[model samples]
Target: MGGKHSVLGNSTLNQSPTIENIQAAYKEGDTSRAQELIKISCGENNRLRLEKHQLLSVAAGNGDLEAVQYLLKEGRVDLPREPTDENPAVVAAYYGHEDVVKELLDSLPGTNWIGLRRLQELDVSDNRLTEVPACFLHCFKSLRSFNVSRNKLKVFPDPWACPLVASLIEFPGFLSECLEVLFLNDNQLEAVPQSVCCLKSLNELYLSHNPGIRELPPELGQLSNLWQLDIEELNIGNIPAEVRKEGPSAVLAFLRAHLRKAEKCKLLKMIIVGPPRQGKSALLEALQTGKVPQMMQNETSIRTTKWELEKPSGVKDKMDSVEFNVWVIGGPASMSTVNQCFFTDKALYVVIWNLALGEEAVANLQSWLLNIEARAPNAAVVVVGTHLDLIDSKFRTERIATLRAYVLSVCRSPSGTRATGYPDITCKHLHEVSCKTLEGFDGLRRLLFQVSCNIKDMSNAATSQKLVGRLIPKSYLLLQAAVLAERLRRDLEDEVQYLTDLQLEQIIEQNPDSDIKDYEDLQTD
Candidate 1:
């Protein structure tokens, strides 16, 4: 027992920190030496000082504001040293140590300290900030990037109205003309001040998720240097023909409405055939027009449309047909249900859409040919590559050549035409269309015209056998249903309005009327 060595005996063998002197004083319950040791070790380069950095930071982490103050004041610890082991400011702010944070700010030298700027990047998300603090103006002036997304700020901070005027007095020219990004997403800002447009150096501004914003200022176009502007969730209701004349807010509103109605509509005819999300719908809209909104996307598994535009066949004939029923068969890849609604004598005009634009385009062409020949022999078969614009120009050229070859191989030549008394198939093909540029649209229109014309000439008797397979003879059923539903809605609204009008009239009638006295009485008086 006497020969046994204690763990403390080997403490000096390795340069491990024992804190023996401090411990001995602590164990003895003597406060004097412990205090003296703390002063000395925290003073400058005491041997154990660097080793105890984690412990010192832990003290700061535990909200020992006094210890933090001591460490910072002793000049042993770097106050703003690239914040490792969980940044003190971040932790303090996260834990709601407002006083400690305030103390740190007060202790920081005027020249070296960046006060509210530290709060910019720290995650205080979901915090409800009604107004921006005055000090933050100083921060914003000096700030290059700020993310206040997902906060509940109802109005633009008052400081933004003047661009750091008050802050500049304290630290002259602290906020030099250099700011780049500002995120005000998920807030309740109805209108942004024109002062924001003055930030010439700014490039990206995210103002998404503010639903109450009804308009954008006309001056927004002045920010010519801006690269990315995110207004995804703002309630912009319409698009205007001219951005400058109508104002930026009106323009954005117009764009939003366009995106909502046009981007995801059945008219876009976007059959997404890629791996997933290669901006197929976006591309379609860009081609259809020039700008697309974020809300235009297919969000459901099954979406069926009964609109005039859903079926292109109806649109062309709308001008001519006094009473006609037209519908088209198309949708997502998940639509496995045969388009029985449109096909009676078999497919009249089959649109073979090859979405992949891959080597399999040839195979797809061949398969479609077989389908057209077997299912609807007389129907005009049109094979289309939907995302042809996405393909590289070089690869697209090669694929076009390959696809044409395959199509010609599968198709039979006209019955009367012959190659040395042998029959051969004649094929027509087209390529390289964009939803963004409106290119190849004319070709598509012409193709549809040819197919529709061919189908119109088919004899009723020849198509009767195929039609009988699923003939309910209900051409007006859908129209009748829609009309009935719309009529009922209108009738209910009219009845309600009529009743409201009668009540308003009764109230107006009940009001007391005063007798007129007259100019004659004044003359007599």
Candidate 2:
């Protein structure tokens, strides 16, 4: 239908494509003429000159969904060892051939063309796929040398490693021994996957052009069969010029040397202390950016959020930035000691009060201050009053003034029940805001940053700790990765409760990261 501008111009439309004619059609990419020629050729010759795999690819690229569906009805189509530029269904999607793509996607699961026991290879090099195609996962057991390079895929493809697909794969390590070569170059991968190390038989790996690759996995050196490992054009800052010049072998060897014995993150625990229905959740959301997760209707006690606080420019140099592990304990249940084991001296306690409760707000604030004193008396506390937007214009100023005066009295460290070790509780600053209107949050952030600048963890100060940079193991984030992996496993199994001390220690010690040397030289901070 795309005019009679055929590759074989002036030739009859019903004429079958010769081997040379089909080759010419392929060079021109996909067009209606290619589809017409393919239809005439298939109708004339049951077995085409080229392999079915090649034909299927070209047919899909030509947007001939009928031909693709017919060809796939035959038994398994295994990709040959040699690479081909024409991607079977991926090219259809890449060229915006929607019908062909729809046919491939719709037929993926039920077709049974690719058997679970067989080994198939695919090369989908230049399709702008942000994620791995469903064909990759469905063909998990069948793939031998899968390639999804030069795409927008940020995640590594290991079906067994992913919990959602793990259950579907009856055998997890099928690809480990089978896969020989992998092409993951020119993508958005953040870090090298240590899981790739499990592919013991892997020979050639292409990881060049990924600018987001900040660090290499330490266990990368353990790949015994690796001969061609490419990291060209990556944006790694720490790699030495000499190592980079020495080529892939030298770079691979350098991975083990880069293993960190220690790692540290400038992290603080910021506790949100307030009563329920007082905008504590909303204020926490706006302040630290940690989402106050929706709790089950029956269970409402505590929620934890990780807030990364960037240091303002022109602040003192030694301390650049810090992460705040914001612990939001609101609702009627979390005020009790049983729910507040997160209290610490190194934390910034943000005590919020509801302005709706006039005098009772002060009583609630006092009750919270008492708890902070009993547990972490020396901790920096910032008092906040929410619902400022609801206050009448005439009364708002007086209400704020009164609250500010009360906070000033508390900052003087009034005499209270004196514990032996705990110091006098003091509120460093008082601020009022409305979570709904987002008023006074910028000033609140500045106050929080000021408190963070001076506050130091007592334990970190006492010890002659040298490597704050190397505490968690820097060169590779596998230690942090192991912890995260364990957390994911727990979440998947619905084991959301805290683990025992012994369990946590075992997880760290064993680590499951080969580069850490069984973490024999482990130290606590």
Candidate 3:
């Protein structure tokens, strides 16, 4: 305890707080003396003349947790709604008294006293807190505005880790769904967490002056209510300068576009099926080196040669810049049966045949196309006529046209006249290519790229649908779990006066489906 002169020496002479006796008691952390002075001032005739800030500020700033708790227990003081120079929460945070800060926040009124319903706004700025207190989420249940600016924090607090947030499943109104403003400026944050995307009601987010943040998670675009985002002095280089200049709406739009592109850019599985020596491998070689293999000898491929086609430069659309995962099945024509395992509705089926064999080429093409269409009913097929350089130049034009028309007639949809009932194979395209001279190779490559882009787009759309379908069930389960847990917690609290680790484990073992077993396991260590 300090001397009476030492306690009151810094206060104004006329102020009630400067009264020598009370000042000395509070300054010396004497909860009993302080309470006695409070009772005298708050006597029946004249209520407590002491200011709540006077007692709270000194106790909190001095890290006197017990004295602060005593004052709160007396029920004579209430937490300030807005932080002022003498606010206890502010003073506690400023002096790094984490326990005192927790006590101030937890003392609010409610069944869940730590909830934010009473305290709508909190500012703990300029405090050198290395991390946000874990109790923050528990204490600030309905908080609409929060600021933790100019702190040494490295990561934002995770709402999921907070017991109050978990309990919100039963009391939806107490959730952070109303939170509208947040300021996290001048911190050491390196990456924005995906958990922030759950803040659907968040509108304004300030994250300026954080030099280490290199990129924002695209999931952040899921914050549909967000209208203002500030990242003024971060190291994020991927965001376009034009978008950043236009502001939040433009930045959100840009992020959405990139997210769509990422979702749509699935690998295109291109399966090349043909007779043993119909230039399937040669086409792959030509696409890789851009040069035709001259006078290639006929060699049977014993297994599949798998390779990928890197997207060429200058391709703008993400759909068009797909990387083709090429799978060329080799060996005898009989091996085509085993190739059915690789057939996928999302793949591009290329059926090649040696056109130099004349009329015999039609049968080879039909056999391979029908086999693939049977396994992959919705797959896109491209009929490629190979060995065109071996055909006589004079007859090439007429022969190629005749072959194309015949193939189209065979693959056309069955109508009133054509009742053969062959699988309705709508060929994507028909083209002739001389692997030796590389005559029509570029056109073939372009067509494959276009088909691959279309298939990837469809796959992305299906994936998005599945994700949305899963969310409804997931949300329902989460709400159910919350309700059940709250009910079980009440039951346990009523049965036992005090909860310990061993007691909680025994209760969980008795009620197996309480869904609290995981928490007990975590506490075991």
Candidate 4:
């Protein structure tokens, strides 16, 4: 036997051991040697030179389970009060030793274990953890801050596996009651689970940098306490552009607005019909950009001109705004035959008549309305009297009254035998507009918005009837052949090129088929 050595100085003798020898023994997995050294260090009346926390941390970090247990049980060493730079559990996790990590967590006091506990924050980030350990729920009921970022997690922690959450669902507060901050960024999560909504106290959530997550559950809106939500670098198209430009408040507003019935807001088709040179195109321009066209042309339009107004003003109370497809039919009464083709039960008819021609306004309005009713019965009509600036102040009142009375009488009258062709017509609104002065345009715009919002689900019967009525048997056969040719081009696997309009016309001329000649006039260059 050798003489005893001082606890503070290096061990020169064989009887006393130093902290370096204990660390070396632990790293070598020599539990017996480590235990023998610990016993000599804690010998009766012996001054303690090394801390137990330091010895246990080295044992746990080396993945020596037996050494860790021997030091904790026989050495009478307490668990680390708080995590430090050399935290044993963090080091074990960093080494990918699942058993050592579990053992370190298992040594912590249970929920009922009485003491001055201080284990609240756990940072197992930058590890090879595929999933969070379920034992965390049982051992660390007081855990408030957790960071599992930069891991291989495909989904969130399953709450069903947690015994505390299963047993406390009926209570006001459940598992993770004290959890305030959670970082699950840079993982392979596809969708957020609804269970995260249970974390009522979670204040800040970091879910950005995940490309697989395409859609967020609508239930995320239930997290009322969440203020800082980071969803950057995702492919979520449902979110409006405003959210990315303005921030989280816009996202909240968008979510709240979409929580309604699907049929409440829909696109509306509006047909603007009347005699030519009644400012129909000018009215559309004013409604679109609020700027009237400087030069007015009186030329008849050969084809229908289309304008679309998305999210127009005057109707914002609904969950989503309505889109108006305004089709203005131009040309004289001869062109009105094409108007029947576009008629639909859900359409709103805006009849524009020149108010400058006082008495003639009655005849003009009646002709357009009757033409529209013949095709689209049951259609909602808005009678707009344009060119009011040209009317004299002396006869303005009389002219307006006469026009209103005549239009109402025609709309109210029964079609009799002709009624079988279309639905009953009704005038929903009557207003005078001035394209040059922009006097009554505001009221007309508001009326169009209100009427379009109410109309819904118009039938397609009128469209089918018009198509069938216009084409003969020979002409119809050519149309079907053209349609089949178009479909073939679309469905063909080969990158086959089709002939242009001029080419097709040239081919038809060289062949000279009677059926093709019947539809030749209908073809456009």
Candidate 5:
């Protein structure tokens, strides 16, 4: 064991710092800052009262061999020979700094590095660490409290076990044996890794404020030691009251009983077409946010939103959280052809017309119908009649019925909705809604979610029933997020209309957020 000497702290010091600060500074390659903080951080005022050996540990963790060399000069600092946090070698090994570990051991003549096999506490939080490197995860066989929170971590490493550790004891369960506290909050994480279930000794988990993080693994219920669980703001909204507001016991019990379901988050193009202020954007806003959309005239809007469905009081795993790439084609008649470019068979279309326009409303509807028929035939369409509030309540039902009949006639006949010979399109349902009163929006929303997820009522189902939805792997979704993030970043730097096939491939291949490298199952949605 290293002797606790007052050599470094023997002089008067101005500041004290926790080990967390040193590790964070080192991680960001702020060597000078770490040195400055460490120099003044001497006495027992902080969590880590830095003495000679602990100061050497900071240098070793940072892979600063020169600092380690200067610190270890001629009994100025005690060299730790034990497996405790005082050991510079263990600190170096925890950060995968083999070079520093070797130099520290070599400096002590006959001394060999005693690795961190039973290190109780490790906190590398407040850094921009994108990953918990597998090599670093290997040696901490007895890691009690681990904190890598407040980092830009998107995903946990695969094979959550280190190869070196795997040969001795089973990987995942080994670390979980003593990992009592885990803080993985405030990251870009999309899905909570299922491997977290391996943490049998995990007592408290802080997973909140992660905007992209949607699904919580049901297997987390297996954590018998978990007393506190904080999960909030998943996908579009907060978790259910029972799970979120209740005690940890209630939350875990709920998760334990909760059935596992994977609604592989579907994304579709939701095209809203209309001329001028017909509440096309309003309809979309109401559907996505469950709030009234302000009626702005002829505004070009393109937005993306998650379909927030109420989850049962149980485990949370991507519950019907479909992402819609909403595109609003709102303009005058001259932009009709340009708008047609957005139409697609896979898209869920909503054609809007101001009911108060009378003959002009019918003509506008007809024109939009023609464009849809020409460009995107047999696509799922929902015809919407806006300005229902303007129509007198006494005649609301009758007026709606009249407009619905006209839409029906247009779709059924081979004749054009106006000209001639217009065949029946895939016009599923027509709903009239008033943007002002927010009437008939519930019906509109219900229909949109239904068609978006391909949910239909089926009677007399079998035991093993095949589900319906645009299901994609969690990997695909993560990849898409990465791609989109990169694309947006590029747009901010330099706006471009389109990306070539080769350019898109480069984006996917270069994405560090996703582990998926294969293009076989890659979806460019």
Candidate 6:
């Protein structure tokens, strides 16, 4: 374990990176061919598993479902390959290759594989799994960790109900009781089955897409061991006061209002601002959706028919690759509101709106910025100029140039990287169609999600620094808080620490501050 090299039979060999082969495949542009060569090489018995893994890397990058299938289906492919940093089955499932996964599993039984015992950390989210196979149920019993979110399932399998004597060649046995992390999100479940709740050992329960499961059985709360309980897409606008009073304010807020939280119990601040009629409401709708939020526009007016986006956990696991969330904010008139809301125990996010140019917008924005440093002094500000369709071409070009020049001069990384880290300068994205046309809207949504993630990163960095000064143990809470914070603030390296500390104190003082005590206890845990 101390040495870089490993013994492969009687010979000693230097360990080589599998990425080299993957890079070669990428350069060759024949991902399928690369996969074939990788399989043949790996089959050498003395071959490096890392090389085969590299082929998987290439396949995932190219989005080659066939190449991916080959790797997963390979009889020699290590199904439980040392659960290194990435779980192979989870990775395969995450990338949307259910057929290949099933084939791989089916082949396992033929070889008297007593089943994968080390598959506890497996997560098959956002895949194309239509039905829960018996093999999968058996897989989960062995899986201490599993995520089956964002797939096309109508009902969850009763793993416990699985016949104990079911033939391994057909239906695998019910998943064993060690199941811990279960993500059954974005599915078509209308009822919360008694069996699911009976899994008293379950910890994190993500029931985001069961919108029709209108009420949670108080019995669910009986699972006292549960830590994270996500039920975001239930479409219930207001939470009962009884639910709010049951737990700490931060946890209750997550359950009710869908407000972002820091993993380290630090403050979160965000600002949303955008121009008039630029699909801001549409953006909000998408952010609040369970799956990839579908966009709808009026045939006549530029107004959004519906708004208010609630971000649910585990929705992205249903997607093929990286997925994003949309955010919509108001124009200059709402700057005061945005600034005020930015002062919370959450990370800060700023959405800059592009006004059609005539409405007292420029003056209002300048005045708002003058006070932003004073009010929410620690927050990260992102300038998003929306409504490119309505702006004049000449004006758009000039504005982009000006914004690009400003960011490059100020926000450039120490390594002399471009402000956007791209060949281009300004981060501004342009779209032509009105929300009525729904044109270029998907691109816009993707762009906003990208920005949101950046902001979130920044927020997390700030929280991480503060954690070093806190008494809390750096557990998953710190990691999750850091993740949530990062999603709100992309880079906290630029944040003013002293200001964050001062603002956090003020935010706590604004309320009865009972949540502060609860969080303090959580930190001790």
Q: Pick the candidate with the highest TM-score.
A: 4
Each prediction's RMSD over C-alphas, in Å, is 24.2, 21.2, 17.5, 19.2, 21.2, 23.1
**Alpha-carbon local distance difference test for all models:** 0.44, 0.62, 0.63, 0.60, 0.62, 0.46
**Which segments of model 4 are wrong by more than 4 Å?**
1-50, 80-98, 108-124, 137-144, 156-176, 237-246, 252-432, 435-525
| Candidate 5, 1-525: lDDT as tens digits | 212221123222222344457656776888887766655554335434345566776677567887777677632576655666446665565454656766666766543234556577777666566767654566577888877777787867665623333234234567877889988888777766666777888898888877787666656766877888877655523234634554556556445434222233455667788887777777767766677776554565444444554422333334445456677877666676776777765677778888887655776677777777667655567778888889888987787777776667666644435334332444457777877778887776666666655532122121111123433444555556767787788789897747787887676666455434432435432
TM value for model 4: 0.43
Model number with the top lDDT: 3
Scanning candidate 5 in windows of ten residues, the lowest lDDT window is 457-466
Query: Tens digit of lDDT per residue, candidate 1, span 1-525?
Result: 011011113322222343455445545656555546656666545456453453333344345576566667774565553433244544454334555655655555673445444433333445455544333245433566656667667765445564444232222243325667777788877765446656666677777888877665533544545656777656654333233243333343333323222221111111222222333344334433444334457633323222121223534432221111223333444552343222333333333445445555545445334433444445444555565666667786777677665555545453434223211234553443555445565565554444433332233332221111111212123323444565577687774322344443343334233111211121111
Q: What is the lDDT of candidate 6?
A: 0.46
Error of 3 at 180 (Å): 17
lDDT comparison, 2 vs 3, better candidate: 3
Candidate 4 clashing pairs?
346-458, 377-423, 378-423
Model 2 TM: 0.42
Q: For model 4, what is the C-alpha lDDT against the true structure?
A: 0.60
Residue 6 of model 5 has an lDDT of 19
Cα lDDT over the full model 2: 0.62
Worst 10 residues of 1 by lDDT: 514-523
Worst 10 residues of 3 by lDDT: 462-471
The residue-by-residue lDDT of candidate 4 on 426-487, one tens digit each, is 44478887888888877776777666655533453312211101213333345446655755
Clashing pairs for predicted structure model 2, backbone only: 262-470, 262-471, 262-473, 263-470, 263-471, 263-472, 263-473, 264-471, 264-472
Per candidate, the number of residue pairs that clash is: 13, 9, 4, 3, 8, 38
